[model samples]
Target: MTSNPPKNPLHSARLSFRAPESPSDDDFFSAMVSDIDAYMNSNITNATVPGSKQAKKYQEYLTEKTLLGVVICLRSTHVDGNESEKPTPIGAMHLCKSGDGMTHHRSTEIGIEILDGFQGKGYGSEALTWILEWAFRRLGLHRVQVRAFGWNVRAIELYKRLGFTEEGRWRDALWHDGQFWDDVQLSMLEDDWKQRAERNLDR
Candidate 1:
């Protein structure tokens, strides 16, 4: 299997951030149209697929509210795992920033979704680590925030392990299987990440 380092996950390897291309009708219909339908029809709470209803609505709201046009970063991998050519997108990370010049102490929200069949692998953790590092370093942003349902222990643990602290808790936030669960709000600051990164580097 191909291997890459998780520490300081981003290296000289080429990954570019660009506006989500003007989606073709099929892309829009598939990602936005279909996702909306799924969200409305199903009781899923953490659906993150692009064409799902929840994703589409969130996209619309984010674009209108933030005006940062969804910035997406894609991965390129060689089919042979050796030769370098067109790289297939194995994952994506979505980002939006505050329009006002309020800087790090302002508001920005991030959403991350890995393609189906890619969960449980370390890819999500690596991607998040690199992106948060970039946001704190390149963007000069102070805070990065995300939300996940309480039942998603994997995600919750991942965020916590990355030094994200619980900022808010909404009890009985989601209803499913004849019961309700909490929705958690998590945030990390540049200071927090810097401290953690320094410790890791020292170790």
Candidate 2:
């Protein structure tokens, strides 16, 4: 709930997004991302063991999946009454392709995590918007998609607010916290993103 962003963070927004660059960054990610509570609504299936060499394993996973990862850090130019000399890693996001020849060139999926302390601080939405823009406009990607569990109402609504249209759902595909949950798929196509951009400009 406090502002402690470093000056000149990457990606040119309220926060920074870069690939993990050091041991400390990995440590921050391993510790913050290994929490059980954080995954309460997440659809990720692999749970890295705390205090393990998660970074290497994670990097391998990304390589195997051909995923591009970015670490989310505090980067602000606002007068939030605080500052940090070094960018603090608060969360991470990834862009992944399906690895199929048909879809690899045109589409990717996005996934993000906001540290527990940073939740509800408008960080997640901002990060997603930036990545979606980068995917469509910068990377020339045709489609960007995301998957959220039905039980995660916050995420479902956030994706909707960001112009992701519901594509379909895998009914009762996930079992977590003592019940079945639907895995909802949502996406934003290139034309859709362009249209949304025009609408925002007209606003």
Candidate 3:
């Protein structure tokens, strides 16, 4: 069985977390389809169709998970107690504690896709840090892993900054843009995270 960690004080960052559920199918489909397109076009250098079969498959997975859960929308931090700024929800991160086969354990593989406009500016880092803390402290996960091509230096740095260590690297795993690029695998355990957290606390 999977367990969530007790809420930690470090997670008091002023941000809102919304479970994956849109008001209507049309909204979900439109938003997700665009997200999938952005992910494919930006991440996969050699991606074909603007939307691929894999995109559809992931969409189907989200739609069929009415009982398990829906995709979450991570909103940005709100400024003063004034008018509420509408969130763009440019990026998405998936979480699942119950799964069949290899992933059925106290671990989760995070796949993040930020929209074209929100590629940088620390949003990815904030969202990932929040999610990892929730996974380790709130969900009591043993470990969390993320994979990205070596070319994605920004993401690599973000993962490392969040206490993730390089666990593996698949040399020349993907051939794109007329050259082969290596895939880097990064991971962080609960203990490792705590150590990092403590060190940061002391600093």
Model 3, span 1-203: residue lDDT tens: 97975754432343344444434434543555556445543355445443445555555555564222233343445475332564344555655445666454688767666665666667667677777777888778888888888767777888898778999899998776577778899998989988887898999
156: Cα error in model 1, Å: 0.3
Off by over 4 Å in 3: 1-15, 22-46, 52-56, 63-85, 96-105
| lDDT (Cα atoms) of all candidates against the true structure | 0.59, 0.75, 0.62
Would you list the clashing residue pairs of candidate 3? Answer: 4-138, 4-139, 5-137, 5-138, 5-140, 20-71
Q: Which is the better candidate, 2 or 3, if ranked by TM-score?
A: 2
Give the Cα-based TM-score of candidate 1 against the true structure: 0.67
Runs of candidate 1 exceeding 4 Å displacement: 1-17, 24-83, 99-104
Residue 152, candidate 1: alpha-carbon lDDT: 70
Better of 1 and 2 by lDDT: 2
Highest TM-score scorer: 2
Local accuracy of candidate 1 as per-residue lDDT tens digits, 125-201: 77677778777777677788888776677778988988899998899978754678787899998889899999999
lDDT, residue 78, model 1: 75
Best by lDDT: 2
